[model samples]
Target: MDTTSNLEEAVEVLQQLGLKEYEARCFVGLSRLHSGTAKQLSEMTEVPRTRVYDAIRMLEAQGLVEIQHSSPQQFRAVPLEEATETLRDQYDARVERLHDALETVEIVDTDDESSVQQVWAMTGQDAIENRTNDLIREATDEIVLVVGDESLLTEDLIDTLNEVGNGVDLLIGALTETIQDRIRVAVPEATTFISGLEWLHGENATVDETAIGRLLLVDRSTILVSSIMPTTREERAVFGEGFGNGLVVIARRLMAQGLLTVRDPKQ
Candidate 1:
């Protein structure tokens, strides 16, 4: 993208990672320079000159910026590689802390177990992917995944599939042979096949239709199916756990075609 857009995106990302606007702006400004005075950084980033020092100090404390001791203090972001690693470590630590804190927060128990199965709906690509990965990680017996769209075969999903413990079968189906080959190469242990689920990419499919994204069935009990909205391209999914769940039945019915047909292919 253009320089201005890149700078804005960088500032936005840094802010999301817990940096204040001024700190993020200052860091982005310094990232483009070897070293610069507060006034120069202010001019480049549009952060007030007086506030640049505050931002610089905060960034320095976070190990994102290095300040030179001089008459007019010079500031610069840490090397890109170093800065990235630092940010990753910080982000991971924060996530760990959040996990720990959340784990300790007692859940208020409501209703007891019911005969009815519950299906959960969730939005956003990252959250869906995380849920899929979590299901894969938790799989003890088998993982059956149908990739309706090739883009859903992300590196994180590949890694999770690869990490499935021994004796846990991994069956991955793709709508196209090319994606099957790609999956086989990336995950040698996985059984990859061309899915018989042609309706996922049927000729009748149009721009107005909600496109299938990914289908994941773990241990024959849990199921997650995501679809991409036609206009927004945003992914939304409904997941259910329990062998008796209607969604589980749907997952089995949806995946039976490919899995049942590929007995000799990868067996």
Candidate 2:
């Protein structure tokens, strides 16, 4: 109801993230204090004598408050701009370490299988495309693509893929008329299909000539199969290497035996 009540709630949320009650209180109280001590802070912020020392200690540790330790510690808030800049540096370092640890865990050793291949799961649209392009650029022989349509692929991305040239055999599934025309404009050399692939019709795409969803085969070693939300517009694609179970194994076998026919788009 009270407009200031919303800001009070936000301050509580920040306090929960590790800000001390006295630190939070002192920081908020400081704007009112202009500068104050344990007693003044206690009076203004409604903090108690028994808990003030503990609160001051927490605030001091956070660098949000400075302590002028005399008979009693006089506390004052660090300037807001300085406090924020200090916190940003601390948080950035913690985040960098976390990212390094996650990247290290991408490959794990399993007792059941030899370490010949690795599979990774990439989330987000940009991440999926980056991993897909990595596979294509790394490919020595071919790149088999089963993508949704041209609307999904931007003009710039298409240009980069086209640089792969004849070394990449692009097998594309156009989910709609829009995709087919876009594909033609993007990669005139790619093999195109209009039938058995699911989810194409809603986008006005022709069905695949074979049963396929989103399958991208990279030089017969890496594969990505996407799962689309049947109801929503969002889609997720999973990337796997040759040594995994289920679809990875089956697709790898198909690519090995040359069963998934590689016909030229010209045909």
Candidate 3:
């Protein structure tokens, strides 16, 4: 790269490593020249001569540059590899300090009755998917899932359910034999049932004549219900957790009453 382009790139990288703009520019300029007086560095880069000494002092404190004792003090950048290693170590140390500081702060405990009973609404497909994945990952014993749209049964969701193994009870409405076959292949250990829920046949039916969206109950304590709008590419979901949450109770009862047992041939 040309001198200007090379300096620009180096300054960008150094700034990302937590150096100030002037410090980055000066250090890069000094690196290029091997050793240079502050005046020369300021002229080579965009740093003003007055600011060059301050930037060099900061770089020296960070162990990135060394100053030579002479009539006009010269600054030399540490070797590139050594500089990068020093930056990495400083970055890691800062991260460790931040982690320690965060641990010392008090956070509200949300596992109690009041917090768990609060229903939260989430919009957009990505947000709903992330919440669903979090529920799946946190499920300790059982997961009851009722899917209205086959498309909502993404590969990542299937993999997560498969990882949880036999504790998952899946009830999918209006699935064809082909789609059922795909689910079987994806999660071989889970009990997959076909639900004859009435919603699958009406005007409010999801795409492909399935039920309207999905209902997920994790360990019977957490519940999530989502509505899918295929034409508009919109998704809305509400979720809450608690032992006696009304949503969780209703969803569990609905799944038990509406779902029909489908015996897998292998089982």
Best by TM-score: 1
TM-score pick, better of 1 and 2: 1
Q: Put down candidate 1 lDDT per residue, 125-183, tens digits, no spaces.
A: 99999999999999888888988877778899889888988888888988888888899
Model 2: per-residue lDDT, tens digit, 64-105? 778777766676778878877876776787789889989888
Give the candidate number with the greatest lDDT: 1
Model 3's alpha-carbon lDDT is: 0.75
Off by over 4 Å in 1: 112-115, 261-267
Clashing pairs in 2: 175-205, 176-204, 176-205, 194-207, 195-207, 195-208, 196-208, 197-208
Greater lDDT among 1 and 2 belongs to 1
Assess the local accuracy of residue 214 in candidate 1 as a C-alpha lDDT between 0 and 100.
Answer: 94
Sorting all predicted structures by TM-score, with the top scorer first, yields 1, 3, 2
- Better model by lDDT, 1 or 3? 1
lDDT against the true structure, each candidate = 0.87, 0.63, 0.75
Sequence-dependent TM-score of model 1: 0.88
lDDT of model number 2: 0.63
Question: What TM-score fits each model?
Answer: 0.88, 0.47, 0.52
Candidate 2's C-alpha runs over 4 A off are: 1-112, 115-120, 199-213, 230-232, 243-245, 249-267
Clash count (model 3, backbone only): 0
Off by over 4 Å in 3: 1-105, 108-113, 165-175, 200-211, 258-267
